[model samples]
Each structure stands twice: as structure tokens, then as C-alpha cells.
Target: MEPTGKTVVVVGATGPQGRAVTRHLLGSGWEVRALTRDPEGAPAKELASAGARMEDVASLLAAANGAYGMFSVQPTVGSPGTAPDFSAEDEVRWGINVAEAARAAGVEHFVFTSVAGVERHGSEVLPRNLVSKWA
Candidate 1:
């Protein structure tokens, strides 16, 4: 069967999980818009070759135009071992950006891939990113 004319926007399309989602969605006959800062990068280009669109996140609203769904996974700042230069605030801000954009674009399905172990453990010991991924 052909695609049902539905489009899914994968916000971290260059990353592992995002790439997997993009590929699966494409294989399943859904249109995929792969989000990335570098459209020309190897990963984004590879996705593009497989029928996923490589688009910049400068304006998520514009990027998500007419999108039926959105899958958002914040950057490494939200991981267990946060990246050297990024803070928790940065991760949350990015997460919020994606969420607000999805809402603005009227995307019906939204998935925010969050980090682990934050709920079981106390926030004091964890990196801010892990504790407040979308806060």
C-alpha cells in the first residue's frame, strides 16, 4: 500500500533512536521529515537517501508544517552522563521548544523521549538534565 499521506517529523533524526524511528516510519509507508542542524551531514544525507527529509530546526513550527506527528528526543544534555558543555536548562529549553512547536503546528501525536532513573532517585544527586528533561 502507498503512504496514507501522513507525515511524521523526527526531531533528532541524526541520532540513533531518531534514525531508527525515521527508517521504520519510512519503511512503513509514512512520510518522514528528519530534523537536523546540518542537512548536509552524513547521517542526515543518508536518511534523505532513504526518503526522509533533512530539515533544519531553526523554526520548528515551519519545519513541522502540515505534520501529522512529532517525535522529540532532546540532546545529550538530558542523558545520564551529561555532555561537557551543555546544562540541564539547555536540554529542557530544547525540549520545550519542540513541544511548543508541535502544539503550534497542530501535530496530533507527540512523543518526547526522556532520560531514565530520574523518578526513582532524588533530583539533588542527578545532573539537572536528567531530573528536569521537560520541566
Candidate 2:
């Protein structure tokens, strides 16, 4: 597809799902602004090389201010070395913050990618990470 001249903000753009979404969006010709904790990291650098604009989460809303869409994908809870410090409540809060920011920015499209079990079961039956996604 030709460049649509539209922009999409991709949160967690350093992670697997976020990277995929970023690549797809860029391939489809939408200007991609990737939000990440570390803009100097390798993954983020790769995205920038591929024509994405990298922005930190703190400044995401400003970068997405006039964007046409937003793709939100957060880190998984219990991820290998990072699980010990992960907080489900914090994850949920961050998700809410991103959504609210996107809405306030008047993004025409919002895509939130949740875990697999979230849609299949209630919160009580899911793990903390999944429950956070459900919330």
C-alpha cells in the first residue's frame, strides 16, 4: 500500500507484539511513532531505521496528539527475569493511562492487545497478569 500519510502510536514498541504491530503498520504505509522506555535500545533503533519515530512513554501523548490510531500492548507479567518486580495493579494502571491518553488525543482507532485467557475466563480463574489484562 502507498503511504496513507496517517500516523499510529505504538506503545511497548520494543516487545515482540509491539514490534510486529509496528512493522505491519509501517509496511502498510502509516507513519509510526513507537513508544518505548528505552529509545536508545536496539529494538527501538531498528524501528527508527525502518522509518518509525521513537518516543518515550512520558511523551507519548504529545507524539500521538494528532495521530490517527494507537496500538497498545503491554509487557507480560511473570516475564522471566522481570517477574519478581512486576505488579498487576501497576500494569492495569498503565494500561488505563495509555487508553485515557489516546482517547484524550482523539485518536480515531484504538487497538488494545490483551492476553489469551482474558477472553476465555473470569478474573478469579486467571493469573495476576491475565487479570490485569482483563481489567
Candidate 3:
């Protein structure tokens, strides 16, 4: 479908995946709302230069109106041996937070970036990992 005035709020706009998605969406003529922790930072500034509106993720709930989609991504755990640790929990929390916020904001679609491994777990550890995800 033609993007036109459709908006997509991309979480972690300052990160690699978010930046690439923002750039592509902007190029495709969709109104892109890039969520970042710091709007005045260099990465956010770069997105602004490309004609994206930068906003804080925590403050994006009500601002996501008319959004056609939401692109969710979490920060990395940052090294080996971290998967079974707290990093896994953190990722799950971030994902859930974004999903809930998107629902509250009336987003029509939510695109979550999840690990392929999560599908393999299939156990109570999923809940444990989710609890620590945002920690």
C-alpha cells in the first residue's frame, strides 16, 4: 500500500536497525516518527535532517495516533554468555512495553523484533525471562 501520510513509530531510532527503517520509510514517503532517548543527540539530529520527527519513546503513547505500524526493537545484551542472564529478560520487557503502548495508542499494526531462540524455549523460563527483561 502507498504510505502517504501513514506514520510508523520506530523505537530505538538512534540504533542501527531503527535508523535504517526510518531512512527507508522516509524515502518511501511515509511520515516517520523516530523514537529516541535523546532528541538533541547526533543520531536524532541526523534523522531530523532526513525529515523525521524525533520523540521520546516513553512519551510516545498518545502521540502514536494515526500510526499505521510500530517497529519495535530492543538494545543488545552485549557479549557472549549473556543470553541466559539478565540481558534476555531486559529484551523481553522492552518488547512488551512497546507492544502495550502501541495498543494503548491505537496503533493498527505492531511489528516486534524477537529472537529466534525465544521460539525454541517453549517453557516457564519464558515468563522468568520476561520478568527480568526490563530490569
Candidate 4:
């Protein structure tokens, strides 16, 4: 694919899946805008060195004009040594926030990463309680 002049905003760029996707998009010649909480973090710095436009989430949304695609992937609340304050509600909120932001920004293609079956119930009142909130 000819990604030249086409920007792809990758969310969670510091994470595993987001990093892989960002790398692939960059390799395909896309103008990559990697969004992260900490722009000075190792992963964001690495992507910046690789020619990506590393920006915080707010700036990323504002600069998404003419963007061809967006990849949203928020990490689940569960994992080894995760903060005890984190909850399933936070995950659902993150997913919804990303989708709404992308839509409001008019991104041409919004690629939402969620668990397979969980997506069907995203709007349900109990989305956060599902086994896989990504759905």
C-alpha cells in the first residue's frame, strides 16, 4: 500500500500491539502519529527517532486532519502488578473514549481493537463487566 502522505494515528504506542502496528505502518510509508501519555518514554522516543510524529493524546486528535486511519488499543486493567485502583470500568471508558475521539476527529478509518465477541455488546449497560471488554 502507498502510505505516503497518509497519516495513521496509533494509540497506546508504548504497548506491544500498538508498537508492532506503528512499525508496520511506518514501514509501509505512512506518516505515523504515535499517541502516548509520555512522549519522552522509551517507546515514544524510539518511534520519534524513526521519524514518527510523537504527540500527546490531545495534540494527536487535533493534528489528525487528512488522517487515513486510526488504531486504538487500550490495555486491559488486569495484568501482573497492575494498580489495585484500576477497574473494568476504566477499560470500557478508555475504549469508548478512543472511539468517540476518532469519530469526532473524522478519521477515515477507525480500527478498534477489542475482544472478538465482546464488541457486540459495547453499548450495553454492563460492558465493563464482560470477560473481555475489548468487544
Please name the candidate that would achieve the greatest TM-score relative to the true structure. Answer: 2
Stretches off by above 4 angstroms in model 2 are 80-83, 119-128
Number of backbone clashes in candidate 4: 3
Sort the predicted structures by lDDT, highest score first.
Answer: 2, 1, 4, 3
> Which scores greater on TM-score, model 3 or model 4?
4
lDDT of 4 by residue, 47-121 (tens): 898878887777755756667789988767664224667677777777778777778788999998755665555
RMSD of each: 2.8, 2.1, 5.4, 4.4
Which 10 consecutive residues of model 2 have the lowest summed lDDT?
Answer: 74-83
- What TM-score would every model get versus the actual structure? 0.85, 0.87, 0.73, 0.77
TM-score of 1: 0.85
lDDT of 1 at 7: 95
Whole-model alpha-carbon lDDT for candidate 1: 0.82
Per-residue lDDT over 31-135 for candidate 3, one digit per residue giving the tens place of the 0 to 100 score: 888897678888899999999988876677755767889997776565222354546656667777888888988899888764465555545656543433323
Residue 67 of candidate 3: its Cα lDDT?
85
RMSD from true fold, candidate 3: 5.4
Q: lDDT of each model, Cα atoms only? A: 0.82, 0.85, 0.75, 0.76
